[model samples]
Target: MQIIIINGPNLNLLGKREPEVYGHQTFEDYFEQLKTTCSDVELHYFQSNHEGALIDKLHEVGFSYDGIVVNLAGYTHTSVALADAIAAIPAPVVEVHISNIHAREAFRHHTYTGAKCKGIISGLGLKGYEFAVKYLQEL
Candidate 1:
């Protein structure tokens, strides 16, 4: 199986940004863990603060990849175009949120992209990425 994890916006600051809410581990470190544990699958990752770049990536892998795990971060609540990109894609997407959106601000509680995903994994930290891949593998 093959899977790609897509992240958006300030995610590049994972380890430094909000250590309390997002944990001290950088996503790069967590990604290495994912690659180590999920060696059986061909896994890839892409992150961009730019919305257009993220959309382009979705389009690039939308048809060819087995599955996609996405954490649109702030874009999850906004970006109708991003949601549309997911909806338009053939690949199954599992939306992930390191911090539980429901437990946070009211604005974070809803996701336009989540509505288009096959399922959603929230509040599980980086473990959610693994779970999303596992779910996609089952499908």
Candidate 2:
């Protein structure tokens, strides 16, 4: 299976951003661990701070990839275009959030992309991406 992990805005600071909420491990470290565990599958990762770049990437792989694990991050509450991009894609998208949206501020409680996803995994840390890969592998 080919899975693409699409992370957005400020996520590049994963290790240093917020140790309490996002943990101390960088996403790259966790991604390597994921690759080790899911050796049978092909995993790809992309991260960008730009909204249009993300949409472009979604459009690029959305149809060809087997599955997509996207953490739209701050865009989750703001980008309808991203939601539409996911909706337009054939790949099953599973939204992931390292921090629980429900447990945070009211503004973070809403997600424009969740409805467009096949499922959502929240507050599961980097492991959420691993779970998403596994879920897609089953298909």
Candidate 3:
């Protein structure tokens, strides 16, 4: 199956940004682990600090992908456009979060994308991506 993993905003700073919350692993390390776990699946990964770039890629590969796993970073609590793009896609989206938004700040509790996603995985750090991939494989 073809699975697309998309990350947004400050996720590029995974290892250095906030080690306590996001973990010590870099995004590259996380990607390698995902690749190892889902070796049989065709995984395509993309990350961007720009919201429009992520949205554009989502639209570009939406039809071709079997499933989408997104860690939308700060965009989860904001960005209706991102949510709209996910909703427009034919593939099932699983929203992943490194930290538990509900326990962090009141503003972080709301997710514009979660409502449209097939399911959500939060507060699990980088392992959430693997869980999402496994879930997609089961589906």
Model 3 RMSD, rounded to 1 decimal: 0.8
- Number of clashing residue pairs in every model? 0, 0, 0
lDDT of 1 at 12: 95
Q: What is the C-alpha lDDT of each candidate?
A: 0.95, 0.94, 0.91
lDDT of 1 by residue, 55-77 (tens): 99999999999999999999999
> Highest lDDT among the candidates is held by which one?
1
User: What's the lDDT of the predicted structure labeled candidate 1?
Assistant: 0.95
TM-score of each: 0.98, 0.98, 0.97
Q: Poorest 10 consecutive residues of model 1 by lDDT?
A: 125-134
Off by over 4 Å in 3: none
Sort by TM-score, best first.
Answer: 1, 2, 3
Comparing 1 and 2 on lDDT, the stronger one: 1
The C-alpha stretches of model 2 lying farther than 4 A from their native spots are none
Q: Count backbone overlaps in model 3.
A: 0
